[model samples]
Target chain A: MVKTYVFGHKSPDSDSITSSLVMTNLEKELGNTEVQAYRLGNINKETEFILNYLDIDAPELLENIEDDANVILVDHNSPSESVENLENANILKVVDHHKLALKTSYPLFLRFEPVGCTETILCKLYEENNVEITKEMATLMLSAIISDTLLLKSPTTTEDDKKAVTKLSKIAEIDVEEYGLKMLKAGTDLSSFSIEEILALDAKQIDFKNVKSIVNQVNTASIPDVLEMKDELEEGMNKIIEKENLDLFMLLITDIVNSNSQVIALGKNADLVEKSYDIKLEDNMVLLEGVVSRKKQVVPIMTENA
Target chain B: MVKTYVFGHKSPDSDSITSSLVMTNLEKELGNTEVQAYRLGNINKETEFILNYLDIDAPELLENIEDDANVILVDHNSPSESVENLENANILKVVDHHKLALKTSYPLFLRFEPVGCTETILCKLYEENNVEITKEMATLMLSAIISDTLLLKSPTTTEDDKKAVTKLSKIAEIDVEEYGLKMLKAGTDLSSFSIEEILALDAKQIDFKNVKSIVNQVNTASIPDVLEMKDELEEGMNKIIEKENLDLFMLLITDIVNSNSQVIALGKNADLVEKSYDIKLEDNMVLLEGVVSRKKQVVPIMTENA
Candidate 1:
């Protein structure tokens, strides 16, 4: 039997990284032993914190897929968000919690739900298959839900996510409020990252109509501290815009405590940001009040306005 | 709340029509009262037989959807296979057993599995949500499974489909061999259909590497009887090919009992038929031994060769 590789979307986050691992475990429990978990990119600080706390190793980094390699995608389905040369790979299954954009030539196993995190759906899969959820797996699942839903505060959080978090937290035997805040704050510490690294932390490439753009978001307790690096961030964003020939680039610095975001918009179609939110961009930046989710609060609005 | 319409693909067959109705019932049981089922086209003979046997009415025909109509898709998801003006509609959910080609701007509920029929997955949904399946729904689901899987003999049939068939047959209080054979034979009775009607019975428009084509399949008990109308069928196919500016058109006349197909090739790239199967097209047709599934056996082979 040919081995199958499992991984998540590029610019790996807590949910993406953890879902890949959980899915791999589920597949193995279902008697598919020829599968291994991989990460599409480097793990962020929040994911690193959880892995260290649980004493779990990070999945190996995957740079490129061999031709006709069998792959199982978690957390995302679009080719744009996946690994390089994904078109050549044979996608055997997809477990995601995002909008549908993937196209395939054959029928495959796909499980998608409008929930906050991919782990929430994976938690259901574990139950449905009657597989035992170990402490490490429960911790991973709980942490991912907490990260994606921002401790059940984001608009994308659904009842399924809330239930999964409750069940997983009890099994993992962790204080949700205490541990969630520490992990989130650890990710917010950007002093060790360069301007480019910070920009690449959670950037997503999206095409709205013909306007190509990249939306990068970073969560912090104090938005003002991240905004202090406005000039350096703009230089890095412009460099990426020029290299990729993008129409727009938005950097959303979100305050996890207040649930608001300060955005820096740049590029030729930067006015689309102002048009979408009906707000003015002061010094190439604006405060989007009560906006935290890029998927719920940003992408759809930009797509409509574009 | 605005009413949401549920439907399947055009050229509605047993699985397509039955899945729409079953999904509507499942939604209603889940507390979604403002939902109704509709069929994209006229129900075929096999589905009509099942509906009449169960003393149920067929769903109303859906011609075109209004702008921004909320809809739930069943059995099929590709835009070309769905209703007109689908791009302007808001798709809330999809329950399918086909390839993933549908793209949405927002995250929604999608459940796709590699099964023989969409009803097989719908059966799991009913059990998962603890919804009771009435006798009518069970009969409809069982008939769809039998039709799509050819009484569990098709290569597309999976273990879940086999299990569903056994369970549903007991609930409906029907004999598997008796009712399945009757339904399968009812669909194969294509003598009442015209050459054009036979061609339109189950036509699917596909684009393979810019080679636009339509692949139509019709099941029959006697291949020679259908072959007697070869001249008229070829003329009608030519007219459609010219009108649609197609590169290829293939008509697969399958014998349900023998599990083989006789294909009629037409259009500019008709030689693709020979290229795909590595066989000569004698009199613009060839016998495809053991080819019963358009999805599993035909489309994938054509795609790889294209």
Candidate 2:
């Protein structure tokens, strides 16, 4: 029997990684024994921290899928965010929490909500299917909600997400405040990564009308410390902009502790960022107060202004 | 406050017409008082029978939507199938039971399942939200499910649809077999329709790889009577093919009583239909035994062969 490969988007965040594992578990509980969890990209620090804390092994990396492969997507649905040759794969199901950008030739099961995290929707799925949420599953669910919503501080946090975090934390027997802060701080450690690697983390390519740009984000305890390497980061961003022929590139150094972001704008259309947030750039950088979510705050605003 | 418009695809079917009204009711129950249901095209005979039987008004026809208008789409999501300027509208939600083909700039609520009818998913929504199904709503829901599933005999019918029909029939206070047969027969009255009207009733444009085709279906009690007008129907089909630059045009004359379809294939790539179903086209037509569903039986098979 052929196995169904379940995975998230290319850059596997905590929500993406956790949703894949949770959906695989839910599918197995529903008697689909041939389902297996995989990750399209390397696990990020936040997701790796959660996996290590729960003593769960990370899903194997999926380089590419063959034609007619049975695939289930979680957290993201856009073909650009998924694995290569995704259009040829037989997508059986998609559980996502992002703006829709998918096209399929046949009818399939899709569950999408305007929630902060994909695991929050997966939590409801478990309750709807009458499957017991195990401690490990609860922990994974709680961790993803924390990572995506910035401990319920981001603007993207919905009522469903808040309720799921409360319920799953209780099931996991963990203190929400204490564990969430530690896990978030664990991901803020950028000492081991090079400037290029930091720039690559959580980078999303977006088209704003005619202007093409890449919006990359990194969570840190101190935005000033990340800005210390602004010269080198700008060099790295310039290399990417030239290679991809992007009109603009914006790097958001998000202060997870304070729930703000210090953005460094580069490329030809960098002034659009200044126009969007109504903040003039000082040396191509500006502090965006209370702007933590790239999806909610940065992308929409820039797309509107552009 | 501006009212949000809820509607379904153009050339509205029973499922599309019923879903828009049901979704509007669901939104009102959820405290969204500014939502109104509309229809993109004229209601069919089957939906007209349902509305008249229940003493309900058909939704007003919507010519077009303005820029940034709030919209909730039911039964369909593709832009081509929806109203004009759909890309300029703020799509708030979608309740559909078809293959996914939508792209949006923001995250929104989407509920899609692989059931026979969109009403089957709406039945689940009413239960999930603790909204009581009134007798009128139940009748409308039951009517759509019956029409889409061909009285629960279509291959697209799922277990959820079967259960919804049973539960809704009790609330609707109607006999399923007796009322369903009448409603199906009411739609089969083709005496009032011209050959062009019959061909345009449920015509769906599909792209099978590079082959562009239009597959149309019309229900009837007698296929022999419909075949008598094949010469005129072929003329109309040929005109549409030339005007639209189509590769093929297939007209499925479905016998609702016998659950069989007599298909008339025409145009340049009409041989593709014979190749797909492994039947020789006698007079560019063949009997498709036990094939009543265009979505489940015809589209997928032709797509695979194309």
Candidate 3:
């Protein structure tokens, strides 16, 4: 049997990790018994919380995939966020909610929508195929939706996402507001992680208009708690910029409760962040009011400027 | 109103042209009033026959698209086969039945399947969306399936294609046997075309294992009818090899009636083809018995060796 590995982006967030699990389960239900879920990075706090809550073990780590390994990608289609040696892999299918930056030589199945979360698309696919969503799976998907949409507060939330959360919450037999707040709070626990770890928590490399850039975001309840480590964070970002030969690096210290973000910009293309937001950078940092999503807010603006 | 330019790949064939028209009509039915169909290259004799039979005018030609133009692609997704400014276009949706090789910075709708013809997928799309398929459209789609699959004789044909032909022929109110043979014979009319035009009729550039190669095919009733023009055709192929800086070029002079092909191979990578079939080239020409479809037989074999 050819073992088909399913994974998400490199920095595995809740949506990326959970959607992989959901897709692997759905593929098995569709009679592809060799499909297995894997994670490209270490499990984040929120994803670990969800797995522990449901009594489900985290998927095994996949450091790198072999050439021509059959795989399914969820939550991302950007080649930079994909596993190493992706150019040689035989991508069987792609179920992503982000931008489409993936190119393959041969045809495969692709389901890309402008939804807030990959789980929302998976919810519709399950209903369309009439596959039974178990309670554990429902909880996993519901947690992903809440995390991606920030408890339905982020502007990226769609009517489809709202609908999926309502339907999935019923199947999971959990109060959405109660469970959602707990899940979001669980993700905000970043006290133990070092500055280097925080910078790598949710970083994604984006190549836009021939510009190589990296955008990293970390959620916190108190913005000041993250800003206090600004010097250390800047050092980490500079090390990454030199090592990756990046043109720009922007780290979003997002306040989850306030729905605002304080950004640290560095590298040669740092002026692009200033031009994108029309704000002056004080010591390479600026507080942008009402900014949260990297997909909805950060990427589009930075891509336009780049 | 924003006009969405819809088109297929370069070297337009029956399926590539007809599928664009069908997709345009389906989009208009779905209430997108600004959608219009276009073609990337000149229509082949076989596609022109189908359009004339249905009394439908061929779509206008498009050389290059404006930056950020709204576009919908049919029949192909490879960047090489797409429009000139496709990298700058805002792709609204893609409905293709070929390998996926497109990359976009933002999310869009993509429907790709590994079917025999793009029209087969469109036939199912129309039925699923509950849009009425007019008789002319049915005939156009039916003609495309028969052309691509060589009246269901090619190895690329699937059960879906057979079913699509059976159902579409009914709506077209024509006997499949009678019209299919006529359509196939109509495409074999290469007497009027120059050697250069014949070589450009249905050629595709494939990047396999990073090797740049070109594959061109032309159908004929008798293999000798095409082989008679071998000197001129070889001259044309040599010109293309120098102009395009190609590594290899293979032209399949396929006999539609006998289901066999005489191949002319040239360029630095010509040895790959000789090794693939284990046949020595006699003046760079060889007879491949029972080889018809390029997508199924030639490409896979040459790509493996390359």
Candidate 4:
């Protein structure tokens, strides 16, 4: 039997891992062919939680497809993104939800909804194919969709995601509202986390003027505790900025409830706030509303200034 | 919402793409969080056929995860194999069927079963979780299972795959044997495909002497077609071997009906045959019987001499 490997991109999270398994299983039900589940990057704790909850293990993480002879790459949906691995044959299939890269193929499944999660696409397939969601898989998919869609609260959320979520909620037999709170509670356990982890919980980076900078916001309800860790975050940010020689750095505090934000800068030029957003600094602090999501808010600001 | 991108490896076929989407949707249902799906590879015509059949567009392929600021890796159940992209948090979660790569968390769900597809695991999750299989999803899952298990005829066909197929068949509203045949017919439409494509369809590389060698095989009902494609495959593989700087090349003809094979070879020692297999080499052909699998049959012979 020919081996078909199912894998996600590097640094895959719950969605990629669970999606690969789900799709692999779905295809298996269809054809009974060989599909190997693989991972590109590390599987975080949240992903593990869902996997363990679902009673499925994670796939072996492959760093690059360059080494694999025959790769059925998941997560990333482009040939270019596959690191051009398996140059032996052209890419056979691609299923993803990000903007299509500059280089792509025709007759592809190229879904681009500007939604946050690739898993939404998987949900639609499950619904359309009429595959019953196992309670565990339902839980897993539910977490992935919510995590990617930000509980359908992200600007990237679309009608499709909304529809997918609605259908998935029914099949999984989950209260979408309560499930959101549970996942958030599970995700926001930051009391004992280090500053590095806190920033990296959902971190991001930007490159401007040939200088690279990184900013991340940890989602948490315990604002005072996060604020207490602010000093450590500043210190860590300072060191990282110096070593990397970044022009600016800041951690935006986003309140999910109020959608309000407070920016904490760690750069020498604190007055350069005008470069990123339309706001003024009061005592080197910037307050903004409806700025809870880092991807929706921070990335745009960074790109605009960049 | 820190934009979380959930994706599978590149060139994801129907399995990877569908699973990622389904799992993401489940997550959203369970946690009401945000998630995105991505693929690293391009979409193939076969998968496109299935997706288009359901009136669903393919997903957007993701760019390479190289040098990605953060990696949410999955599949491979180890941080060690995570491609060194993000400087920090190298490992997030490990989800895989292969053995855990070196160091991983202890509380991981490591599934090391020698199964044909990861969808089997997903099927189990659905069963255990009591998630009802939808007709559409059951069809897709059935296709995937059939693809992985080779219509429940291949040696890799596990009892688990059979059980999943049986259960899914009921939900899919189809007869198992009939549906299996139809799905296979749909999957292996080799009429318009080239020998190069047939060779690349489910080909894998074997490395020996610090040099990589590729093995391609095609299983057909008749030997004539295999013989017809022999020259094309040889020529194509020869160029691939030279350009890729591989050590050796070989392709096998597995006549499923005859339960035999006509193994073909390339490279400097193309005429040589392994003595142990009782290969009756009439010219360059290594004739045999009950040898329908390349991985189990031809690969052993090719690597025996290496």
- Model 1 CAPRI quality: high
Tell me how each candidate scores on DockQ against the true complex. Answer: 0.90, 0.84, 0.60, 0.02
Off by over 4 Å in 1: none
Index of the highest-DockQ prediction: 1
Distance (Å) between predicted and true CA of A13, model 3? 1.1
The native-contact fractions of the candidates, in order shown, are 0.89, 0.87, 0.76, 0.00
User: Candidate 1, after superposition: displacement of residue A69 in Å?
Assistant: 1.1
Give the per-residue lDDT of model 3 (tens digit) for B1-306. 899999999989998899889999999999998988999888888988898898889999998988989999999888889899888899988888676677777777777767789999899888867899889999989999999899899888889899999999989998988888898889999977888889999999986576788999998888887788889889999999999999889999888888988999998988887888999999999999989989888877877887
Clash pairs of candidate 3? A106-B99, A107-B99, A107-B100
Candidate 2 or 4, higher TM-score? Answer: 2
Candidate 4: list runs displaced more than 4 Å: A1-5, A9-11, A30-32, A40-45, A64-68, A72-92, A101-109, A128-132, A208-211, A243-245, A267-273, A281-285, B1-306
Candidate 2: regions farther than 4 A off = none
Distance (Å) between predicted and true CA of A279, model 2?
A: 3.7
lDDT string, candidate 2, B1-306, tens digits: 788999988889999999999999999999999999999887889888999998889999999989999999999998988999999999999999899889998999889999999999999999888899999999999999999999999999999999999999999999999999999988887787777778777888888888999999899999998888999999999999999999999999999999999999999899998999998999989999999999999888998899
Name the lDDT value of residue B150 in candidate 4. 60
Tens digit of per-residue lDDT, candidate 4, span A96-168: 5542332311111222234556667667556656777676666767788887666887666678778877777
- How high is the lDDT of residue A148 in model 4? 66
Better of 1 and 2 by DockQ: 1
Given candidate 3, what's the lDDT at residue A91? Answer: 92
